[model samples]
Target: MLTDPSPTRIDEATIRALPKAEVHVHLEGTFALADILFLAKENGEYLPGPAATLFDITTHDAFAAPAVSTGGGAGAGAAGLSGFLRFLDWQCGLVRTPAQAARVAYAFAARQSASGVRYSDVIVNPTHWNAWRGREIALMRALSAGFDEAEQDGLCAVGIAYSLLRSQSAASAVDAVATLASARPGHVVAISVDGDEKVTGRTGEKFHEAFRLARATGFRRTVHAGESSGPDGVWDALDLLFAERIDHGVRAVEDPALLARLAADGISLGVCPRSNLTLGIYRSWDEHPLPRLLAAGVEVTLNTDDPAPLGSCLEADWAVTAEQFGFDEATMIGFAARSIEASFADDDRKAALRSELAAVVDERSRTGALSS
Candidate 1:
């Protein structure tokens, strides 16, 4: 029997206890302060100050400063989204060997598991790995080994989405898609594009051939759009790349026709509320378009785009969205279902997860334990 997807008051504890899947997390953005400090020590690198100082600028108050783009894309400088990208690049640069990459990958999956994530489709943009760009196959294998360790430990099942940076050359994007295509299929499930949409201006036309190659090679597609840009970016991602899902597509709220198309086509939007606020995309949670998107029948799923940099996590994102949107236990469960439905996890894994989620919801419903 299908449970009603109506609002029913739930609490933070209930939200945390629910099994979930995170599809928009970045491997480059999962580094903790301690991890950074440790990595710096291991690499014999110097820090300007304490590790905490590196992340202090991500606070809401700090975001009041105008963001400056360094023209090379988000990874170009240390301010705003560009600063976050620089941080990501610095973190990626810290891993100088396949072994180090494996360690980071394992730690990422382990962290997500602690947050109650049963499955994660973590994105790793090869363009950021200046050290390992030409050696992506080795990097993927190392990361896969680490993910294999986590899966064997019964922590969380993991998959990679080989991401392309819009700032990178078209040749590099094509090479990335080709690399992922030739990689072990179990390690990579999708090809995605991410970076400052503002820098690239949502011109999906730039990578049309690459995406066509990805589709022809049998890889699923997702694209980052509608975050810094507008609804047109999301449309380009759909109309040009034929993306199976969208990352940070909340700007679709600005276009009714786009919203209708999303609903009609059943496309999923990986929405990140805290990332939006921290990035100054929206002023507040109430001002976010998640509620509006859900009301329009869009399949919206919550995610933590970059947990450490944004100082948010999957559970926290869910809790904040629930509180802001007045989502009840039922609606919360519906979000979980939507995530599972939208994920690139194989049908068998999806079936198992859906069953587990349904069982949990039913149990909570019977025990009336959804409230604090």
Candidate 2:
């Protein structure tokens, strides 16, 4: 049964112990500063930030503190987006070979384990990886190889979401869909659209044919919207791309009608509180509309959008959201359940994960590990 509307206290340990899936994490943003530093030296690449402060963002204490003002305050919405994206490019450039790419994917699974993420639908936009300009299929295979190895070793399983940047041409989007469909990449489960929605304005109509082809080719659909853009982008995702899941749909709270449609359709929003705050979507957690979205019956799930770069982890995101927003234990459990359900993983895997989730959460309650 669900708890009262008034939020109850739930411990971070309990939230971490609960089984979950990450549906919105970007593969290009998964590198740790240590990894980046090591790779930079090995590959002789340029790193934008000073080595001294680059690693600071990975610390938990630093994450929960005031935002790192690299020309953007907490409220300076998208002020330093170019710098942030430049960092992603630099990180993606470090993968000089397929082995290195595999290492990135392998490390991602290991890192996610710390946050109790059992599986993930990770987005990989080729726009960031300039090194793989004409060899995206090879890069995808390398990542898939790494994820397969991790899954074989009982690490967090991953599904690749081949994303179309809103910055790209509609013809390119169609070509990408066709190429992916022809290749039939076994591990690439979904097709998605990402990048600065604000900068791209609205391109859903342009990519509608691509998304339609993606559906015909058996690719699940998800889209990045309602974070950098208004609720209209989300509406485009739903109405044009027919996205089944939305990444960072917090801005949908601005539209009552959209919120109602989302709830009625049972579409889940992969909300990353830390990313929103860091990106200045909302000034603070209290200012975020997560609670209001919940009240409106939206299926909300917590995720770390760019965990390593943003000093984020699923455990911390879940914990902070619960404590800051006064969510009860039951609500937190619902988060895990919803995340797994929203993932692009296979049905058998989802069912197994659901069972594991139930068993773990139930055991925690029984053993007093999770106090209600």
Candidate 3:
């Protein structure tokens, strides 16, 4: 017999111990303040504030205010998505060599490992790495080297998702897809599009050709939509880009038809609740649409879109989701299973992960740990 999905239970420790998959994290957004300081010092760059002070400000005030311009092109204070992107651009500029890229990747995996993330699909936009302007292949190789090292250490298995910026021209998007298809980095598995959806308006038609080409080349697709835009953006992503998964697609709750379609098609939404809150997408966790989406039968998975920047982790995300939504152990475990199913990992890996999760759940159940 199965436990009730809606039972009133809170198990923070068990939630932390659950093996999960994070499919929406960004490589550009995972750099710690220490990492940033080290990179800046190594490259003779300057930052707005002391490393500790800056980290404290960004993490604590992330949702209090929009990121303010520091007059140095990078954002300061608790910046929103646009400001964060500028800071991310500046950070990416510091990584001038493949070795630097590898280090970043390795550190990101190490962090995820500490949070019990067994697998990760990390998104990286090549356009952000201005330092490696014409050396995209070298950059990919460097990132792959880092992830390979992390895997060897039993940290986590990672796959790269090459992301297209919505602000870029169609030609640039096509070029990126072509580069990804040609390079075919061992760790590269999917193509994604991310940017200021409010500025770009979630217009998927702009990159239809690029996404189509990516699909033809055997790459899976995901799109960032419904975070800043609306259900229309999510619709455009499905209709135009043929996205297999949607990132931050909570706005689908507003459209009954869209919810029905998603449930019928079994499409998964990689939701980042804290990201939505910090970005001003919702006033509070109580106001979030996740509960409604779940009730509507939509497959939902929790994630940290930009963990370091938002001061969030996969474990924390799940814990908060349970606390806020009153999710029981069974419901929480279902989210974990959904994450694995929605991932682009191979069937063998997915099967193994599922079995591992099942064993954990069984052990916890037999020991009565989940009910505690």
For each of the candidates, give the backbone clash count.
1, 0, 1
- Please provide TM-scores, in order, for all candidate models, with all chains considered together: 0.91, 0.91, 0.91
TM-score of 2: 0.91
Model 1 has an lDDT value of 0.78
lDDT of each: 0.78, 0.81, 0.81
Can you write out model 1's per-residue Cα lDDT over 232-274, one digit (the tens) per residue? Answer: 9889999999899999888899999999999999999988887
> 232-337, model 3: which lDDT tens digit per residue?
9899989999999998888888899999999999989998877777666777877899888888999999988777766767787788777777777788889889
* Model 1, runs deviating above 4 Å: 1-9, 57-66, 69-78
Please provide, for model 2 over 200-249, each residue's C-alpha lDDT reduced to its tens digit, 9 standing for 90 to 100.
68888999999999999889999988887789999999999989999888
Error of 2 at 283 (Å): 1.2
Model 2 spans > 4 angstroms off: 1-9, 55-79
- Worst 10 contiguous positions by lDDT, candidate 1: 69-78
